[model samples]
Target: MISVDGLGPTDYERADAARLTRLPQHDLLVMAGARFGDLAPWRHPEYLRAVAGLPEEQALAALFVLGRQVPEGSLPAPLLALLSHAKIVSVGSGLLSADYALVRLEGLTLLAAWRAAGREVGSYAPWVGTDTSTLCRLVAARRTARTALDLGCGTGALAMTAARNGARALAVDINPECLAATTFNAALNGLADRVAVRQADMAALDLGERFDLVISNPPFLPLRRGALGWLAGEGGPDGLDFVWAIVRQLPELLTERGEALVQFASFGDQRGPFCAAQLADELPGLGLSARMLLKPPTPPRWPAFAERDEQGNLAGDLGREYRAYVQSIGATHYHPCVLSLRPGDGGLTIGRYS
Candidate 1:
């Protein structure tokens, strides 16, 4: 649970909601794109210049949203104190820096560890990315459900979002830090009673129960291990490690009328995401029908562990090594997709985002 400057979440929800509202919706999205859109181009000069042009409140909010440091006095004292009490920020030497980032999506306030803040967070810091956003939107669309399961859970945003829709949600994750964050966020949003957390590997999960709804944004990166060798980002030798695991369990995990949504990136050939073919081959055997939403394709990228030179260029023959690896996998394009599944005869429809 989160405390706001000596007050509990209930008090904050009743009295301090306005002061904590970070930024306008449009401004927030732009800031997020600036902060996290390009992983390789880690620094964004144009984004900084753009933030320099917003109104004072928005500009200050941008500093925290982008995980940049500013003078302690620059932000309102009450807001700073509230965030500080929640362990969302740290103040030292009269400067304020973010430990967590606050995001308001679909009328829900969510907290996640700030990746750009350069803080020494746990290996499984809550993932808040495009995939999270996509799943949250899908959760919000479901007005109600008897029960919901969030396989990855991350910040617990998906579970909380489902709880808000009148569903009892069980949030599962292998990372204790992630479970802690989810539990705290559930209380912060006044949904603690409706949400429960458990630590478990989704790859081999069985709880002797089924849910009316299920959702996940599991790790799909093809790297065997990331720079930190974190399991949260690794998808084994093939990117389908977790994807296949989830597919294997869906038949038993979902109720008769249940629905599931999973967002992940997959290697693609000229035809499209490999899921299209995998679904035809495997999902039919499971008696599940699917609708897939795909985004435009991009070239394969080197893993996060690829070494970089002083100028951020690929070090040594790392580029050649990455090319050979991509060739060995026969993956020319990277596809990001959300797959929706339900119990039915094996029918698959694929649509691309414009």
Candidate 2:
């Protein structure tokens, strides 16, 4: 289903796998990263050589290169076709890398491309043993719902899992590219019909329906600006902008007995108890009752920034400013917490801060 002509492995005419065996690990990764840029041809041979001896990392890096070069929503078909024949083993987290023998097939999985470098690698999906996953499981265990909603479903990991466990689901995201990836994965797992993918901002969903359950791994990172990867990492100035909005809107979106499971990050630099507590305090005013299902301390770090400016100065100070802010927070770390909420009385009540 993927066009193999212009973008296939054969297109790297100058890259010889034999030469890749001689390049150092660092050089290979750098070259591979460069190959994703407009300078791809200039770096092709070097990338090929760097990736030669190292199949796993090479595959990872190549996929990363491809991700940067390819248009969003266009990656899945090619990747799926590539992974069709191989047996993929989980490398850890949601990462999957293939042996040289299985390279052709495994290279196509989005997980492989993501690990290659298209996306910053992290425990973004809560299903992979994150604080979010713990909360989702807890809610599912108690509620026993037949249908659920995964808000801001990045790769549809949570949505697919819910479907596998007998919950028909709707996975929503604002990024059409992400929805395409989710659709690819859903088809791969033969759950396409059960897990519907929709491209829509969570704040203004118009599904014309409500659910017995709703879950989200919303963008809670407090970034000053947005980037290409999952916005789930940028939660706005207080880092609670999206989370707070979601909490307030959830009660109305759920059935009287419906429940909501959400995950968010709280910065140590924040003024009072983290935003989770703030949400709890305000929940009552929104006619909601909520409790902390899981809260794990996540270290706070400097926000990621681009090196260039509007004037295109190579020597920008924005990166330094970001680092300085992180240091000033006295925050060597940050914490991510998961909360479960339900409809409650008219008056608000704040729970004990963690």
* Top-lDDT structure, candidate number: 1
Q: Where is model 1 more than 4 Å wrong at Cα?
A: 1-18, 22-27, 30-63, 66-86, 91-96, 116-124, 304-306, 309-321
Candidate 2's C-alpha runs over 4 A off are: 1-136, 139-143, 227-233, 269-272, 304-333, 346-354
lDDT of 1 by residue, 140-240 (tens): 99876789999988888899889999999999998877887787677767788899988899999978899999999888766554533675777765566
- Superposition TM-score, candidate 1 onto the true structure: 0.78
- Cα distance off (Å), candidate 2, residue 158: 1.1
Cα lDDT for residue 263, candidate 2: 75
Q: In candidate 2, how many clashes are counted? A: 15
Summing lDDT over every window of 10 consecutive residues in candidate 1, give the lowest-scoring window. Answer: 115-124
lDDT of 2 by residue, 1-354 (tens): 111223223322222222222324433232333345521322456545655656644544443343222222322334433443222212334344332111111111122123223244433331121333344455446436678888887656667667766888999987654565566555545566788877788877787778878888777545553642554556665467677777877866787888887776666643323555566567767788776643445556444333555654323454555555566656555665666788886333333324
